[model samples]
Target: MLIDTHCHLDDPTLLASLPEILAAARGAGVVKYIVPGVAPEGWDGIARLAEEWDGVCPAFGLHPMFAGLYDEILLTRLRSFAGRAVAIGEIGLDYLAEVPRERQQAAFRGQLRLAVEAGLPVMIHCRRAFQDLLAILREEHVQRVGGVMHAFSGSPEVARECIGLGLYISVAGTVTYRNAVRPLEVVREIPLEHLLLETDAPDMTPEPHRGRGNEPAFLVEIARKVAETKGVTVEEVTAATTRNAVRLFRLS
Candidate 1:
């Protein structure tokens, strides 16, 4: 079975065809999904989806792209989902975003603290700000409750650094792209034990399916590419990644 470690299933576009999407995913052996929150307004909808679906796991957090929306009110709401959430995330620093770095750091740190307090892992998002992100993660002592670096497209060296801090590097459908030099290198260099698979559905669609709306069903393409890159059987890649996901999120 495969677990989509990161998917925006709660997004309205996907939700519009929930039944069909989930059916296709299950058919492809994508048994579980971890849906993360990007904003306060989406949290309730995510919670409801998790409740209604057998394999839908929910994670609550504010994404770095939406850092300006972070505040005490959002934190309090996130805390309420701590007991049920698999991790605290879809949170971290995004230097590309126009939001002030200070505010993004503040939000990321707050959620990290909450993750620590609740004894849960995190799902970190980072881009062009690894220096600051690493510094903040260390300052917050995040090694205590390690998390996954969601949709990681960083170098193998960066992947190693995150692994050193007890974090997992999650690869998305981008690995299937022929032009994806960096991600392909990462897949070849990083051990499968520290890797997780995701579709980042509704985005990051894999080859042959590019320009189409992504879904968990396309995760098979990613697994095929990872196996091809690492010179392992697809079954091995699937089993190892699924095990890593279960262990990291403490999934049943």
Candidate 2:
């Protein structure tokens, strides 16, 4: 079985079809999923999903794009519920988009501290802010509980740096794209123990499914691509990634 380390089933796009999506994912060899919390508004839905599905794990954190939602109230809520959730994230820094960098970093730091206090792993979303992200993590000392670099998009050298910061490099459907180079190199070179697989479903749909929104069901395609890149079998990739997910999130 495979664990989709990152997916957004709470999004309205997939919420309505969630049951069918999970069935298809099981048919495609995916049995478990990690649903990350990006916005406070979506926390209830994701929390409810975790309750409804035996295989769904929940993560909560304020994403860079939603800086407005980060506050003491949210932090209190995160502190209250962190123990129940598998992880604390869908959180990190992003410079690619026009948002308040100072505010985003503050929120990221606040959540990182929350994760440390809550004693849970973190799921990070980094974009065009790798150096800053690393700097902040180093300052905040995120290695205390470790984290995952979701939908990783960096060179092998940067990937190594992230690993050094105590993070697992998770790849998405982008690995299957013909134009993918950096992620392919990282996947090919990174140790299997440090590698993870995800779909970032409802967003980064892999090839053939590129035009449409992604779902956990398409995780098989990403895993197959990882296996091909690493010169291993799909089952091997599945086992390693599932183990990675289980270890980081403390999933049963």
Candidate 3:
């Protein structure tokens, strides 16, 4: 069985058709999904989905894109929601966007502390800010509860850094694109034992399916590409990644 380690199933576009989407995912051999929240507003919806679906797990946190929406008041609310979540996540830096770097840094650090305090793993969302993120993680001594780096698009060196901190590197549909040499390279370089697969559904659709709305079902193509890159069978990739997901999230 395959596990989608990072996906936003709570997005309205996808959530509206839950049964069909989940059926398609299961048809593709995707037996489990970890749906990480994008903002405080999305936490409840994600949690509710997890409660309703046997294979879905919830992760709550403020995404970097919505960092400005977070405030001190949300901390208590987050603590309550996180109690039911598998991890604290979809949180980190996004230098690719216009959000002020300092503000994003503050928000990321705050959530990191929250995850540390809650004693939960983090599902990070980093983009073009690996060095800064790594520095902050180091400073915070945030190695206690390492988690997955969602949609990882960094160099093998950066992947090593994250692995050093006990974090897993998740490769998404981006790896299926022919132009995604860097991501593919990282996939080959990182050991399968530390790798996880994701689709980042409703986005990052793999080749031949590009321009179409992505779904968990497309994770098969991502896994196929990873298997090819690593010179392993699809079953091996699926088994290793599923094992990594269960171990990382402490899922049953």
Candidate 4:
């Protein structure tokens, strides 16, 4: 079985098509999922999804693109989740979007602090802000509860750096693309143990299924690509990545 460590099942599209999405995911051997919240408004939805599904884990945090929605009140509420939240995430810096840099940094640090205080791992979303992301993670001492760099598409050097800081690099469906030069290179350089698989569904649908809404079920194709990149069997990639997720989130 495989675990999709990152998915946005709470999104309207995925939520509206829940039954079909999950059925296809199960058909692909994706037995578990981790859905990350984008803002306070959606936290409850993520929680409800986990409650209704057998193996769905939820995380609460403010996305960089939506940093404007963050406030002290929100941080306090997120902190209250503690053990109930699998991790404090999909949080991190996103320079690609039009949000203010300062607000993103503040929210990222606040959520990172929340994760440390809660003693839970993190699920990070980074885009075009590698150095800034690493700086904050280092200053915050994320080693306490190592997190995963969701949708990681960086060089092998950057991957090694994050690993050194006690973070796992999660590969998404982009790895299945023929022109995915950077992600494929990173996967080849990093060991399977440090890797986690995700579909980042409702967004990056793998090739052959491109133009369609991404879903957890597409995880098998991503895993197959990971196996090919690492020169190993898909079974081995599945076992290692699942163990990494279970250990990182302390999943039952």
Best model per TM-score: 1
- The residue pairs that clash in candidate 4, if any, are 25-217
lDDT of 3 at 69: 77
C-alpha TM-scores of all predictions: 0.99, 0.97, 0.98, 0.98
Model 1 spans with C-alpha error above 4 angstroms: none
Quick one: RMSD of model 4?
Answer: 0.9
**82-154 in candidate 1: lDDT tens per residue?**
9889999899999999999999999999999999999999999999999899989999989999999999978
Q: Which lDDT tens digits does candidate 3 get at residues 7-44?
A: 88988889899899999999988989999988887788
* lDDT of model 1 at position 25: 97
lDDT of 2 at 241: 88
Q: What shift in Å separates residue 176 of candidate 3 from its native position after superposition?
A: 0.9
- Candidate 4 residues 102-160, lDDT tens each? 99999999999889887889999998899999999999999999999999977899899
- Give residue 110's error in model 2 in angstroms: 0.4
